[model samples]
Target: MLIKGFLDALQPEPILSVSQWADQNRLLDSKSSAMPGKYRTSITPFLKEIMDHLGEYSPVEEVIVMKGAQLGVTEAGINWIGYTIDVSPCPMLFVEPTKEVVELVSKTRIQPMLESSPSLAHKVKPPKSRDSGNTLTKKEFPGGILRLAGANSAAGLRNMPVKRLMLDEVDAYPVDLDTEGNPIDLAKKRTSTFAKRKIFILSTPVTKGLSVIEPLFESTDQRYFFLPCPHCGALQHLKWENLKYQYNKSSKVAKEVYYQCEHCQEGIQESEKTKMLESGVWIPTKPENQNKKRVGYHINSLYSPLGWKSWEDLAIEYEEAIGDVPKMKTFYNTSLGLTYEESGDKPQWEALYDRREDYPRGKIPTDEIAFLTAGVDIQKDRIELEIVGWCEGKVSYSIDYRVLMGFVAGDGSAQVWQKLDAVLNETWIRPDGTQMSIRMMCVDSGNWSSEVYAFCGRYPPSRVVPIKGRDNQITIISAPKAVNVTRKNKSVDGVKVWHVGVSLLKSELYGWLRVNPGDPGYCHFPMYDEAYFKGLTSEELITTKNKNGHTVQRWVKKFTRNEPLDIRNYARAAAHMVGMDSFSPKHWELMRNKRTGAVKNKVKKKSDFWN
Candidate 1:
């Protein structure tokens, strides 16, 4: 009588279709059958609707379900398995990520559902006796056997021709399996021969990038369900961002916040939302028979009767404890199958994309380019130089490579300086017989400052620039004031070279240079060097302030180390060429007019001051 009453209440009205009526009936009673001499286990309306769909045995070859946690998705799967076993009795395989999870499911969830479900309990025979150590598989009256396998082991999934395959938490499966291959691919092979085979892939969404489960969800044959709004009568999907809340300060309580209708722009409270959802219907949005074997459903925690209190209570607790970001996002979007708008750290890869189109290998164009800069990354025994030649606003060519065996001590310091001098002189000459000197050659003065200084002194004045790398900002230290030394009837040349900070150069480059996608001019000597990029925190960079209370910006290095070669060299070279120095024409003229050769040693005198 109880089962009959529930069934009669569940029957569709004349105007409603079978699926529509089933949805209504399941929502009202929440139970389908009653068992004699056993405690009645109430079914959730959501699970009952799924069970009803299974009973129909539609031609749908697959069912995809997106569900909130603790909505008994696993339980529904088990019940469906039991139903299939009792009605049809075919080979079935249940695949999970690990053996431990399989064991837990088999012992706890599966066993209890079979024991408690009155419909399943009455149909299956009692357990048979076997050896104490080894347990025999339990068989219900129907001859179907349900086997459990772990995806982690390749040997476990071999040679299994199954009619139904239930893949739980497919997203969490390891990308590669020991011997069988990817767990998903291996499991699909098990059902290759069976034309009427049923496969169900279900999981909570993870990262947005493509993964194994994404292919199934992307298929057009799959179904996506949307609930209609009561006030505006618009079909809509639930999103975490739209949720609003009202708080009571004295009681420290929070209630379900209202959301403005996307269509009507009117506030819809939880009560109105419930009414609208109750009247809403879920139907197949795809065409009649294009990849028609698949079905997908996204379930939220709000749909579960028992889950309501927890959801409401958590919203209140989270608002008070840690703020709304995690609780609202994780619980609503991940735990529940709701959409969320993400706002946080932007990927550095996006910046890299802007220069992508400008980096293709092609013939170097001969034109009057405005800026020619070289960034040198220095090492103890070797140095790398990236020469960027820009024509108009586009990058013409970038030569990124290293020069080895330039060690100062190994090859006498003079010899090393001589080689660098040769390279610089070569860069200044144009292929068409004109002198195309680089506006700036940023030499790295980080580790070997003395050697760099020695080399700078030998070059023409105003030609070589000194650069310092600190934090993110590169500051060029200005040339010291030239002091007159006329004592003891002797004259000495003071240090007159300009010192440019790399941070200053980096600022200019970031501001003026537009690195389009594939820009060759945006070159790093050591490509994708993490040491220059990952050290500093974003918050530290953003919150940094100068002495005058303005935001102080610095370029993040692409590599890690006390002295980053690529960034340091690039900054120094660019700064020197951009004329970011205070120097007179006489300085360059005086140094250029001097004879170029190795310096000769002279006897020391009291008046020979090392100024």
Candidate 2:
């Protein structure tokens, strides 16, 4: 009690805005900070009001910043830290998405802030000092402790009591930390100890309805940073829809992109950004914001500091992101400060089953079929495999799906694998008596990897590949990487492990399943049985709310057995191995003629009576 009284007495009586404090003491280090000079609010003048209102004297209890990248959002938070530490000393908790981020901010932002500011540097001594209170994740000051914790660690957010809470990149945080409920709510519990506590939630909005920041923004008075029009002087928020650009041939635009005036329809030159930004004002759209305890602000990349990322830069990024939904979604979230919504079109198993063609299983390839690839799924009791046919436009047909029953011996020899070997090279007769073999086969190396490697090694490298699944958003099938194995002629005969992004492939497969049979990239199945369809559609793509209030898609199996899906993915991966993705019509024509040409030549000649 005495310590609290003494600390309160020691605190500077005069109120100082975070922006003002930053201008006076914040020095941008050339090594780490983007701007290497004394901090100036004039640069990101739009954020100054936010910083000032967040000061100790302000009535605001929470500030939510839903902003685009490079708009000084992080800098604003840093400024608040500077204010809380230097002006009004108090215990603070800074939460990032992960421990890595906590360490990152500590190294890049917090450390630099202390080293650069003389006032802060004096109080928070360098690590070299004997009594140095500063560490990697925690900083100790005279009257307050700045604890840096990751949202991933529930204990970090729950145990500590703090007057100020800063949650950075809240959208990146998981929905639950170690299953202790929402990290935001857990962190909020710590602030109840201090009546004058301040909470700052800042993030680039992620998925619509799934985003953490958007709901908070809606609950508050949604304020937009309004800039005066250079021509008409009409106040307006910068929106992406108002921006205009022209695309030239080659699908790449070298032309300029500019923001058009909504009031006067005039082209607002990028040069006018400074004058406009200086005159910018945040106008709250909701009436509840007048209460002053909670405030929300949203900004976009268009308002990025002059000479930084320009409208033209954003235009180029948009051009590059064409046809790529994820890339484009990232741009919208980070640059436009918007949420992306998935199509929510989940394909039904019965629908796919109903669409199965009359193509007889393992009999003949249709005219649509070009080449065949195989995928092998290893199990303790049986080996399941699928032969998939590929043609122009990524059209796929399931040629055969079978289960070879046998157990692998300790010596790596298995009757199932022998059965696999027979079928792996066996020819499938096309409609015109043409012969086709599995061009490339990818065997799952996840289970019994040693045997899989040994089995794959038995075949030609080009014909057989060991595959494993990867958890990544971008790649469907990555290039071969090293696996756990030892072999002679390691350079030439080493077992290659292909990494397949199962989630990405599943997403694509489901999307294709939604497509009509005649459509491009449509997937076709033979009338094998109901179980096959069940395996194909065993997994459902579930979109759940992440910690950041953003929606992320994950494949959750409805049933235990998803071998059909796994083997299909493997066949698709094998198809990639045989250059199915970018295969030209000419290439397909040559491949289509290969088997028929061989059959024609054999039929034209008579077989010898004696071998």
Candidate 3:
């Protein structure tokens, strides 16, 4: 009768709501966070209603939160897990983008939640306890177990049935897992055995229609957190555009950021957000929201903590990102909680060709030139070269493109090599008769590796760099490494080859091609042959399943002859080598004055538009 005696001793406490329990017990520790304190629902009142849905009374089978970074989505999720452990223990699954995230969350979030809360600490045994079922990926309680896994692992998704499942950063999750149809569907199957199952999915959206969270949110009763203006007393949703301030062009900053009341036309300071959120309520556009078992909530960084991402902070970030394509994409996804829309396809070859400016092939106005870079594409029969002029805001002007006709006769002794040398040394005369030579040239080492190494070896590394196209996610260029197995496959001093991220540059270039002229990051097209535009627009980005059944994106050619695109990609890489990112305003003025040899009339700033 040991069990009976233990049951008698264990007194059943009064039932309390999840939020009520958290306010009375949950603690945030210094080990896991800087703001360590007891839990309070008032800090993020908008989430209390969402987290309480995990209780037995709520019928929501699914909850989707399309949120930005540092918005407490992860913390709210941990609260639900703790509530489950203390009140209604059941099998749960916590999934992240990868195995590393799973391990990280276990150590950072779950551990702190259990150790900091007395009720949860007493219910769940620690790792050292003899009967405590605690591990990095799995935790077993008296009646239930919590399992952790990455979306990439198929076996983990199918292993055990669960009553509660959470998928963090759902947009980053691989579209598929091995042969499993969909990771979401696979994870959903695990909860099928339990009649009362709860699943929570959250992420910052990726792209329109392709984002993992968008469709899920659209299908549910789409809900948004609406707050009443402190002055106007009128309820309205917080949006990025609602916040406004003066942008100082010279300083590259928004002077001040304050929300304008749409109804009263009064300014709302961020300091007042605390009170406004205290009176906030979530409104659902779909009336049948209560009827549906699934619900969705969307919130942006606008609702983040006061000191965390203030109105001015977000404003400055937007001002900086508006001029950069990749940064703008990130802003859309993270700051606004919106999906980035990729232009339908690479700019049509005809469109770019037809929009060619009056500028001659190689006579780009020196005033418009900030720096110059050249790309070389080596082929068995010939080599291709392209010179691109980069100005402020990354607006690149096509200077000239030429094809050298010859073959590699005997190890860098070909006429093609001589032509390439002449091209590299040739200076393009500007409108003012000032000459500008290529500052950096990238020669393709992927093909004709031995010959390319020999030709580039003849020149100093500062003048010519041997490069091969590679696919990377972070940046356009990777650190220089030993050339791919060469004639001897031996390392040479000062002989380093760069890996150009073809995929990264191609994506950025495509974005530039789509932006209208006069816009930041717009790429200028000079008078070029139809064939040149054809090759430039030859490839398009496509999403398809990889060998692991996971969805991936890459550029694929529609037809043949993509050398024009290749040269452009290489030129972009060369642009980085010549300080494309670090150039100061003084450098641009110096570059502009090189042609006329005129004393600086104006101290040009980085924000100045290209001439």
Candidate 4:
């Protein structure tokens, strides 16, 4: 009794107002206790960390958080919602990916917190009537109501007028719904009226291209907390490369370390990281005007009070389990607050850039140019057409790209003929009155053979041809042959015309296409697929004998596996067919000399013949 009285006396009498004492008692009672039937339970540290941030209201309009799995981020969000309801009441919407998640979160995380937290439970009253399908309005505190909706339903999100929007697991939200708009965009409309609205988009990283969370992260005002280096007191980003083992020679694995100071070159250990935490800083260095007033937090299980010790133990266990690689990159990035590149895949960008210069634009030769051919790969809805103008000693320029839509009619037979006729009318125009048309246009008749045949009937005997190949062995239906045409009676413009086979046109194109490295004009063809250049593998060009004992030299793709679109092969085949030369003599000689055991042979074939 004496000690209690002394402690009370020391507490500055006037400072202990009824409200201040009540607030302290409320906070003390809220701490978790082992006693049964204790209404006030202590909030978890993870939740407390988030609550602390919310406790300080700033001008920041949004918070963008990137988190690892199971760090109570959802629970933290729930607490924030409840806190807002108690203190600053506004119409808020909680959005989840599906109806199931919405129901689960409301029942499990939100309801329990409001019921248990004495301060919050006292402020917000119960719902008027519990059974409303479209609206579940609970008058918890006084000023406003909290609305819950699933992003999965467009009508549910679209109708709400929300001041604060919490989009949960945005990465999981469906990008495109046939009848409804994108869920994220639909949710954003709910808060369009409120200028001082708060928006929180939180999600774990998913595969690169499609995830909706990417846009929020790219925003200017989104602040990422940067930790300073304890060793040198420099502000630096935590990266995976900075962390290394204590002994480089003895240890094969890298230890958990922070980036060294750029000036001092000293490593920042995890134990000393507490000094570096800057609570409110934007990431990626955004411009002042474009900033959205945001803060980001990366949460990991290591920060959880429940699993704190377990995290340390698991780190040791994981070191033994797989040498060094974590189950997912999120494990390292989230726990250590560092960034890492996605592992295990080779990027296709490099291969495309390597051969970028090889394909260039050039003038169409007047005298030596023999024929033009088009290779059409037709699909059900779309068609990929590559048109090659063939000359004897030049690289073929892809002059036209046509992407056509609409369904084909009559089992695609009539449609193919119509498309072929349209293509001929649009592309095959002669300067003179003579019918200057492609010698032959090859259609991938693999899927629609009958359609190809029907289309071919519209042209002269050898003008339209079908390509035949199974398992990458492509061959023209008719070999290269010439058809003579002469005017019966000679007139001023009357002249003889010759129709050539598809193979003859291909042969002409092959010689004409040449790789000129120095000329930018010939190097700037943008239509070529970048993936084709990247996937090219070094292979042995072999001469093999056919069944008839004829030696045929074939340049085979040498990769261990085959890619869906072998651009190099297609380009080479297109070049071969159109008589486009691979490169000039000087360039070819340099390449030949650079390669080991490369032989230069001058034996001219039909494909190599000029005019």
Candidate 5:
């Protein structure tokens, strides 16, 4: 026994790549994985090369993968961690978007993976009551410690040096952590100390100009998996355009689905996918960068394993997402692993003016109008307001645009404010003879904020609300912040002020403006003059470098007057705050019933008139 032990110690450590190591020892816990058994690279053969590059023997410094959801990339990342702990035994760090997510992943995924694998379980002990090193966020093994951190926390990213760094869902990470800088840059600094370090970056990219992963992926060789056609043997990467399906027109369900080969024009069935995936090869689009230290791979849900996310499923999802911006964005980001490109260029004002519908300006044109909202823009000399009618599917109609020409400063502000109140309180009739009043009003407080707050505070908080525009906000409207209002230079009662993400709303509005009528998120206009169209399209989205030397998108005015755009943004915010964003079909039906019921009550029958 002593001789055998000595011989084992003398024998060189077995050389195994990350894939080989995972296939030999990694076990997927039943609690975490759908397929809870031994890990097999064959199941997701496309990931075998990606994992092998992360092995301890590889000289590649960085491996970046821009991928869609449920492509087994996360499991592949866990496999690398397992191999590092058992074989390489070096300090490693895993950064997630938030600390809460890190904790959740640690308890749900990392802990289960370690506890289920015998080789890993023997090395990394489970967290104990007294063991600080072996906890949810930190795991200690023979020669290395695994630290899980959040990209939002700068301290967590900078506190330690790590030989291997893995950033999962990097696009979800905060742009700047505690104002220190970009989280990716901060985390990358942690691996600079190691001579031969491995860095893995993975994410489903969010947007084209703003995505962190897309740019990183572009910097590498940009490898894509190419599979040979089952019939023609011609090799090509899968594309959404080549995917064809036959669906029932009435039911909108897929009847038949197949991938049309680019070369042979033959339809490949789903059954042939497994063999094709197994025989696939990764070819770099930019072959000159093949020798570069950083390598990148991009794969969409089209290549998702046989049992997961079939082509038929994607076809049906794409059909359902048509004409809807948010759903289509999800289909592009989460399914195709592609950035949803938003056209930032200025939409044509002439086209919008020419296409104005021949409808009355003051009344709702259609019974589809669910509710009404008003956006008030305060200027030094005048107040501009637009009454907008909103319906399901984010279809909006411009009901009225009024320019209250009165001194909106000091004592004269009261006249314009009172005029705005009169307009807001006014009832507009729909074509069905049902009356509708402004459900919500968002008044701009950026200019003459105190006066705006005082004016908005006059009404109930539900009706009129003050809003401030923020360029950096992620959502269109966040929770309102209470602010103390001042009257006569003395503090009055506090009022709720909502922060509007103007940039996001503007992007949405621009996209909506480009869409034709009858499409989801389409914007309809009355017979307004050319000036209104010009004001609506006054600003152009431009990409410029910030003071921090990072590229940032900004909306710059091409014309002097942009109150139309600002007012529309506020109206969008008001709709969001009123829960229109989450309103169900039942809510819309209830609103319609209320409007129709009120109309019915106004009319008296011939028998009731005598009584």
Candidate 6:
């Protein structure tokens, strides 16, 4: 044993890169990784250089990454933490957005990481009841300690001095922690004591102006991964615009999904992605800042490896997210790794009136009409409803609007509801002689709550949706909630009401109303009178201070008759509930075929009757 120990001591210690160290020692836990076993950097070759730059030997002090989801960036961070523990031990701090997220990552990610690799497990001991060194938020090794923190906690940011700092999902962090100022600024102060400190900031960006990572990313030498096209050998980075797809007519999947080379316009299949990635290289866009001791990297989900998020799935997701603002925002931040820009200005109603189409008010215009939805607005003396035809890409046509004048509340409300039932049940004729029925109808419960609920409850929940509008809701439409109503001194059960985000819907509608006729999400209107246009443009969005003294946007009526705007948002809510938000091109094609086939069969039946 002494002879062996002497021989081992005589051998020189080996220097290892972070990627090499992770490949040799790290094991991906099944609990966290899709493929659980020995970790291999070759699977995602784009991450190798990023991981190596984070190694102890590299001179780079700070690394900023603005990345999309499912790209193994977070796993690279875990590898860095594991490498520090197993190889170059130092005081390290990892910060998530909140305490709850820190707890979740510690339990699901950090703990499993330690247990998966023997080298990491040996250095960072498991927590026990009596062990203070190894706990949920902290881990101690031979030469250093690892601490987990939350950006929301001021105490966590000020707890200790750390040489290695990692801020994950920094965009989700609050602007100020307990009014102590920026959490990132506070966390950076902890590393001032160490000259060779390393800082890594990573996030999927949020809004353009409100993003925390975009400005930080702009400060460093920005690096992007470029791959050579297999067909034409042209080197270029993958872009959302370059990805093309054609949906299958019979199936709900893409018939063809390919990347068009930016240089040669050659088609590249997904199977060639592996070789392209293996040969990919990162080039700094700001080469002048290469020696600044800081580096930044940006990549989107298009670079995700094969079997992880395919190009087809991204195309379909983008297609479905085209018209909905919230869904588009999520796709941009999570799939494109970019911030979403919001347009809050209202569109002028005069433009809409002048560009109105000449289609008939009560008939479907063309095969473009995939379905129909109606929105009902209840007033004291009458009920106003608008029927809207929805097409692919959420292009909508204002088909018809009717007012039933009567007592819509208290005594004679039953007759008004009966009139509404007839309008809802009417079949509208398409230009091709195909018949279309109202798929769904949303009745506003804001004016006469009990009466609206009673009218809506008469039909199936799918046919008639009762909705109450709420300001500043996070989502456009929420799931329906069952409420009890009292009738004749007895409580009735099972009336579902959905809460609608009027503010968000109005924002989306006004944006679409501004689009030209040929563009996606453009609104087409029939020949309505001047008063109709006035009511449609009745409310204008105004910025004002709320009770908390914070700036907020509110819709205030410029005209007394705002039923057109109210009923339009209700129609949008009906469309949203009936899957308009997620319908792809194939879905529209199927509906079109169904209507055409039905019309042909009806003609054949009439011909056979004459024969």
Candidate 2 structure quality by residue, lDDT tens digits, 224-267: 98999988999999988888888663545546667898999998
Model 1 alpha-carbon drift over 4 Å, by segment: 1-56, 122-128, 131-141, 232-234, 247-252, 272-277, 284-290, 306-329, 338-611
User: Is 2 or 6 the stronger prediction by lDDT?
Assistant: 6
Candidate 6 Cα outliers beyond 4 Å, as residue runs: 1-12, 132-135, 231-234, 249-252, 353-507, 515-580, 583-611
Q: After superposition, how far is residue 132 of candidate 3 from its true place, in Å?
A: 7.0
Stretches of candidate 4 off by over 4 Å are: 1-57, 70-75, 123-141, 246-263, 278-284, 288-326, 329-611
Give the TM-score of each candidate. 0.47, 0.71, 0.74, 0.44, 0.80, 0.67
lDDT of 6 by residue, 1-611 (tens): 99999999999787688899989999887798889999999999999988988887888889999999889999899999989988899999999987888989989888899988988777776687366488778889989999999898999999889999999999878775787878999999999999899998999987665577887888778889999999888789888999989975336577589999999998999999999999999988988767657999999999999899999899877876766687888799899999776555656778777988898889888878888889999989898999999887788999999999889876656787779878865888888777888888899988777777766766677788789997645467876788877665644457799999886677778788877777778888999987888888787777666443333456788878889988999999999888877676778878765663221111101111101
Worst 10 residues of 4 by lDDT: 602-611
Show where candidate 5 strays beyond 4 Å.
1-9, 24-31, 115-128, 134-137, 174-180, 247-250, 354-361, 374-385, 402-427, 437-504, 516-520, 527-531, 547-549, 573-611
> Compared with the true structure, what per-residue lDDT tens digits does model 1 show for residues 285-374?
555534546666766654444324344554564454232232334454455554332232323533533333343222123333334556
Alpha-carbon shift of residue 76 in model 3 (angstroms): 1.0
Sort by TM-score, top down from the best = 5, 3, 2, 6, 1, 4
lDDT of 5 by residue, 1-611 (tens): 99999999999987799999999999988899999999999999999989998997788889999999999998899999999998898999999988888998999899998889999887876577466468878999888999999988888998889999999999888776788999999999999999999999999887667678888888888999999999999999999999988877447689679999999899999899999999999999998777657899999999988889989899988987676555577788899999877556889999998889999889789999888888999888888999998888789999999999887766545677668867865887778888888888899999888778777766667788899998655567767888886555555355789899787678788889988777878999999988888889899877777666766667899988898999998998888877876676789777766753221111111221111
Q: Against the hidden true structure, what lDDT does model 1 obtain?
A: 0.50
Model 4 lDDT per residue over 1-611, tens place: 99999999888534222122223333222222232242221323323333444432445667666665555466556655765665557788888877777877666556655556676666654434353222232333466767777776776677758888888887667554435667777777888898777777787654333335554566434343454556655565444345444423224344453445565788655555434442222245454525435655554433334323233343543343231122233344445433332231232444435544343333232322334556665566655565555432343344444556644434443454456556655433323222234444555555644444344433443444445433211121224323222222311111112122222222222222233533221322343454333333322234455443323333354454222222222333444444333344455344323322212222122221111
Least well predicted 10-residue stretch by lDDT in candidate 2: 601-610
Better of 1 and 2 by TM-score: 2
- Evaluated at residue 95, the lDDT of candidate 1 is 83
Indicate whether candidate 1 or candidate 5 has the larger lDDT: 5
Strongest candidate by TM-score: 5
Better of 5 and 6 by lDDT: 5
Encode model 3's per-residue lDDT on 1-611: one tens digit a residue: 99998998898665666788788888999887667999888888888888877666787888899988788877888888888888888999999988888999999989888998988887778878785779888888868989999998898899978999999988877665686667888999999988889999998887664578887787777899999998989999898878989988677677767899989989998999999999999999776755568889999999987767778878878887765655676788888889876543777888888888877787775467766888999888888889998888788888999988877644444667878877766767667666677878899998767778766766677778899896423346777876533444442334679888686577777778888878877888777889999898888878776765544566789859999999998998898887776565778777767664322212112211111
Per-residue error (Å), model 2, residue 183? 1.1
For each candidate, the alpha-carbon lDDT, in order, equals: 0.50, 0.79, 0.80, 0.46, 0.84, 0.83
- Give, for candidate 1, the lowest lDDT window spanning 10 residues: 534-543
